[model samples]
Target chain A: MAKYLLLKHYRGAPAAVNDVPMDQWTPEEISAHVQYMNDFAARLEGTGEFVDAQALAPEGRWVRYDGEGRPPVTDGPFAETKDLIAGWMVIDVDSYERAVELAGELSAAPGAGGKPIHEWLEVRPFLTAPPTITE
Target chain B: MDEALLRSLTPSVLGILVRRGADFAAAEDAVQDALVEAVRVWPADPPRDPKGWLVTVAWRRFLDATRADAARRRREDLVDEEPAPGPAPAVDDTLQLYFLCAHPSLTPSSAVALTLRAVGGLTTRQIAQAYLVPEATMAQRISRAKRTVSGVRFDQPGDVATVLRVLYLVFNEGYSGDVDLAAEAIRLTRQLAAAIDHPEVAGLLALMLLHHARRATRTAPDGSLVPLAEQDRGRWDTASIAEGVEILQAALARDRLGEFQAQAAIAALHADAPTAEETDWVQIVEWYDELVRLTDSPVVRLNRAVAVGEADGPRAGLAALAALDDSLPRHAAVAAYLHERDGDLATAARLYAEAARKAPNLAERDHLTRQAARLNARRCR
Candidate 1:
């Protein structure tokens, strides 16, 4: 089995088909969306595929070292220019196709009008530790 | 209580229970129970016959569990015929356990977990810690592996290569939590070598020993990767290297060379050298040639190109590299090293940066980034 990260982007990805923002959605629709995502993760856990899931705050900053004994310099959140990550779910599935299927199901979470968001979720495979046999 | 002694006896004891017609999963569970009991009781009341004690205790636990399950009363007759516990055929039993744990039906991860638990005698919690997974996850994986292999006949001969691959995987995991998997792997491989007379087993043991000998030198105090050529040779474990060399020499003498044996020969040559500059690159290249013939793996060819660079010049190494697919992992890194050797700083720096982006692990990525940074700083100077 291989681990894949299903990334839900806050800003950088292309617009979803049901593109209404979360705040615009009816409270019931939002609840349904959250419920769907939770059920999906719970089902994966039952199947032993779930590794982890985490949501990120949209606000973030870039920090860099000033010098050996100096305080680090911090930059703006740069919301307009940055690719903001909303959240991520990590899955250990039997195949890439299975990861894709799960990601598709996650993308189908109910939106503003109780329709599928069909959001563009980025799926990235984690590079594994080098095998022992590698020279 | 000596935990090592307990762990060492685990496989043979479990094997005996299985041989006595206990289900693989049930027998394994019983053995774990016996081990826990031994730990609790052995400090105050140590057994004179540790193996016999474990078998008797574990077998009783298995039978108790079986009789307790009313539906499994059909197995009552089997449990009633408890074989007399005396001297066991420890060698065959241990080898079969290795085979069952590394069974082809199980996935690699499942096989690894099962091998570590059933064959290596590690607890599920310890294995979970080592793999950085939750205990429940590891427990499920292991139990699933046991169920998968339950139907297989215990007496069937197992493929040596599959067993070797699993041990190698364990060794590569290095150390985590309270378990030193590399040492554990070496212990298992050594045990396997004693049980079987295959030269490849000796080859794998030698390879592990030679690699493990340099483990301390392979990383810096700051947790940075130390390239092989830059490692402090004086810090290497001479005893391990000497033992590995002795084993390799013996395996090579057998004339039935395998991939592991050829790989060990290359490692032995490197260990033979007093200094990086004095390494026998020509002979190493020849060994690489042998390795290419044995496995024909692209990774081997990638490595062979590196050896070629050392033997002939960077240009010849580059030529050798050109024949291989560029998509192979570490191809760019190898090219970067060769370019740096050939004194093409610009190309080397660029390639090093590219390699860093595609590196499989954090340490290697950091090392490549530093290489690129070093060359760029030199150019500016």
Candidate 2:
């Protein structure tokens, strides 16, 4: 089986169909969305597709190499316009189509008014180790 | 008390339970339970007949499990009516166990995991630690694999080639965690050779021994990759080399001429050299020719080009390489080495950088990056 990552972006992605931010949603709707995400992960575990999932804080900075013997340079958190990764879930599935299908379902997690969010998700494949029998 | 002896008897004990009409998955679980009991009890109360003790304990566990399954109570009565087979025949089913574990229906990863557990007698926690996966994840993987193969019968003959491939995969993983998988692979291959009279099995064992004999010198103390030509021959294990050569000689005499035997012949030639300069490149090229005939694989052709370069010259090697697709793994690295030999330093440096970016492993990538840096530094000087 091959592993793929489903990425949720906080910024630098096209606007979703629902478009409302999580903070703007009603409390009932927020709970429904959380329940949907948890149910999705539990279902994948039952199907043996779930590998791992994680959420990232919305703040980060860049660091770069400096001249010899000097401390490395650092840059602060960028403006809201910058691309930010919100979180990701990794899944191991039998086919690329199955991965895409799962990603679509995850993107449909409930949003404001308890309707589909239709958010865009970036799917990336993990580069696997080379097989022993190349021949 | 004797761990190796207990482990070696695991497959035969498992085979006995399965032959007694126990399902493959349940029989394996029963054997594991028996092994746990042995580890707890055998130190103070070592049985005179180890195999008999294991068989009795494991079979009882299986019957107890089946007896608890209310749906199988009637079937258990029918099975209980028939007398168990004699000892020798039960032990002989070890070969069939290998066939069952390496059944074609299972994926390569699944087959390798199952073989280590059922045949090599390794614990699930040990296999998980070796592969660097979480224990629960590894358990799910193994149980899923067991369910996949639960329907297969043991009467069908298995392909020896597939079993050898699985063992080779295990060996390639080398040493990880507490378990040395390469040594485990050699042990399993030796067991298989004892069970079957096949030239290819002997060839695989010889190939593994020859390769492992050189493993100690393949990397530096700092864990950097050492090219074959640069390794210290003084550190090579002569005993292993001699054993590998002896096995290869016997297998070659059989005239089957399989791919593993041909590959082992190449490894033998490399081991035969007193020094890198004394290596018989011409003979190695001849063996590659034999390998090409045995398996017309692209990887073999790529390796043949390297041998041809050594036997003839860089230009000849590059000419041979020109026929293959440039997209192949290590193609750029090979081209870089040949170009450096031909005195095209600038091109060699550029190709080395490109190859470094494409390297599949961390060590190889670092080695290629250093090569590129060395060449660039030389040009500036």
* Candidate 1 share of real interface contacts: 0.21
TM-score of each: 0.90, 0.87
* DockQ for each numbered candidate: 0.33, 0.24
lDDT (0-100) at residue B32 of candidate 2? Answer: 92
TM-score of 2: 0.87
Question: Which portions of model 2 show Cα errors greater than 4 Å?
Answer: A1-9, A12-51, A61-75, A80-83, A90-135, B71-91
Q: Model 1 over residues B149-193: C-alpha lDDT tens digits? A: 989999999999999988888898543467888899999999899
Per-residue error for A78 in candidate 2, Å, reads 2.4
Q: What is the interface RMSD of candidate 2, in Å?
A: 4.4
Lowest summed-lDDT stretch of 10 residues in model 2 chain B? B81-90
- What DockQ score does model 1 reach against the true complex? 0.33
Top TM-score model: 1
Docking class of 1: acceptable
> For model 1, what is the alpha-carbon lDDT of residue B251?
92
Error of 1 at B274 (Å): 0.9
DockQ of model 2 vs. true complex: 0.24
